[model samples]
Target chain A: SQTIHQWPATLVQPVGSPLSLECTVEGTSNPNLYWYRQAAGRGLQLLFYSVGIGQISSEVPQNLSASRPQDRQFILSSKKLLLSDSGFYLCAWDIGTGGTETQYFGPGTRLLVL
Target chain B: GQQVMQIPQYQHVQEGEDFTTYCNSSTTLSNIQWYKQRPGGHPVFLIQLVKSGEVKKQKRLTFQFGEAKKNSSLHITATQTTDVGTYFCAAPYGNNRLAFGKGNQVVVIP
Candidate 1:
């Protein structure tokens, strides 16, 4: 079975501080990884996605960036956090070659930028 | 640009009642997938439909893909309190990337 793990389940940071969130998947290799954010009572917003190592695609321009350092390790980072950056961040993985592939999500990390 | 839209942003239903949510896309899709997210939890893959006019079922849940491949729907029979959550419809366009609908928040009242 495939599973995704995200760190810092919850975080509180002051404005203008640096932020880093990590996501790692087990039981799969060369899977597609994605980062999504959701504000309170709002819908999920795609932030970034990576098909392979060192390859990242930005879906929405914002204060965040994503990186794939290893086949199953993805990281979302921000040099400086903004008040609007407060939201729940999620990591997902999908089988790259399968038809009608479904994304599996991690527990998610909630950040509160004050 | 491709866009997917879901109707009834929020729905309240009595336990054991039937419920359905519709998803529409501006452009044709190769396939459509459904996901469910419990309150305060991450989204979970529910099902996927590919062929035009295809229909698949899982227990009390039924999924449909439109003949035009521009729409889809998820129907649940005899909803339960455990079904309270937000349902999202995702469609993959030309790229492997998926675009998700705004989602329909379902609240089952017991």
Candidate 2:
């Protein structure tokens, strides 16, 4: 069975500080990875998606960025965080061709920027 | 731009009562997938419908895909407190990335 893991289940960062959240999937290779943010009282919002290593598509422009450094490893980062950046970050994987596919998600990371 | 919307942003049902949520898409979709998220947990895949007017069932839950591929619905029979959570319907709009509906928050009262 395939499983996804995310680091720092919960995080607290100061405004203007750097941010890094990691996601790794075991038991799957070349899977499509995605980054999503869910704000309180809001639905999930797609931020970035990667088809392969070094290939990422930005869904929405904001203070965050995502990278697929390794086939099974995806990272969401920001050089300087903003108060609006605080939200629940989720990592998802999909096995699809041509960009239309079903996705599986991770436990997620809750970030609070003060 | 493609968009999906769900009706009844929140629904409160008495345990054992029936419940249904509707999903509508701004543009035609190739397929639609359903997911359920517990209060504090991640979303879990429920089922997927592809063919037009397709209907699939899992135990007490029934899913339907509209003939126009522009709408869908999820119906739960005899709801239970365990069924309390948010239900989301998602569909791919010409690409692999799926656009999800705002979701319907279901609260089952025991």
Candidate 3:
């Protein structure tokens, strides 16, 4: 069985502060990893996705960026935080290919930028 | 990029009553997938429909893909409090991206 893990579960950052959220998957190799954001009572927004190590595709461009340092490790980062950046950050993984496959989500990291 | 639209951005249903939410696309889709997200939680995969006009059921929940392959619908029978969540429909497009509908946020009143 494969499982996804995300950390800091909850984060509170002041304006202009740096941000780093980590996601890791276990029990699966060469899986497709994705990063999504959901604002309060809003729909999921695709942020980034990776197909292989050192490969990252950004969906919505902004100050946020993503990097896949290893086969099972993905990281979302920002040099500075904004009030609009507050939302629920989700990490997901799928088998075989990318987006089309059944995706499994992590517990998620709730970010609050004050 | 291809996109899907969901009707009734918000749905309020009396517990035990039945209702349906739809996902429509302007272009034909290879398949459609459904997911449910509880309030304050992440979305979870529910089911996927591949063939056109295909209908699949899971207990009280039913999923259907249009014969034209441009739309899909999800019908839930005997709605319960546990069914309170946002339901999203998505389809693959381009090389490695899935287009997602805005989603239908369902609220079941007991």
Question: Which candidate's DockQ is highest?
Answer: 3
Candidate 1 residue lDDT tens string, B43-107: 99998888999999999999999999999999999999999999999887545577888899999
Query: lDDT tens string, model 1, A1-114?
Result: 888999999999999999999999999889989899999877888888888999998988899999998999999999999999999999988886532498899999999999
Per-residue lDDT of model 2, residues B1-110, tens digit only? 56889998899999999999999986788888999989888889999899999999999999999999999999999999999999999887645587888889998888
Query: What is candidate 2's CA lDDT for residue B98?
Result: 79
* CAPRI docking class of candidate 1: medium
Error at A82, model 3, angstroms: 1.1
Q: Ten-residue segment with the worst summed lDDT in candidate 2 chain A?
A: A94-103
Each model's TM-score for chain A is 0.96, 0.95, 0.98
> In model 3, what are the clashing residue pairs, if there are any?
none
DockQ (Cα-based) for each candidate: 0.57, 0.63, 0.71
TM-score of chain A of 2: 0.95
TM-scores for every candidate against the unseen true structure = 0.96, 0.97, 0.98
User: Which of candidates 1 and 2 is the stronger one according to TM-score?
Assistant: 2
Clashes of 2: 4
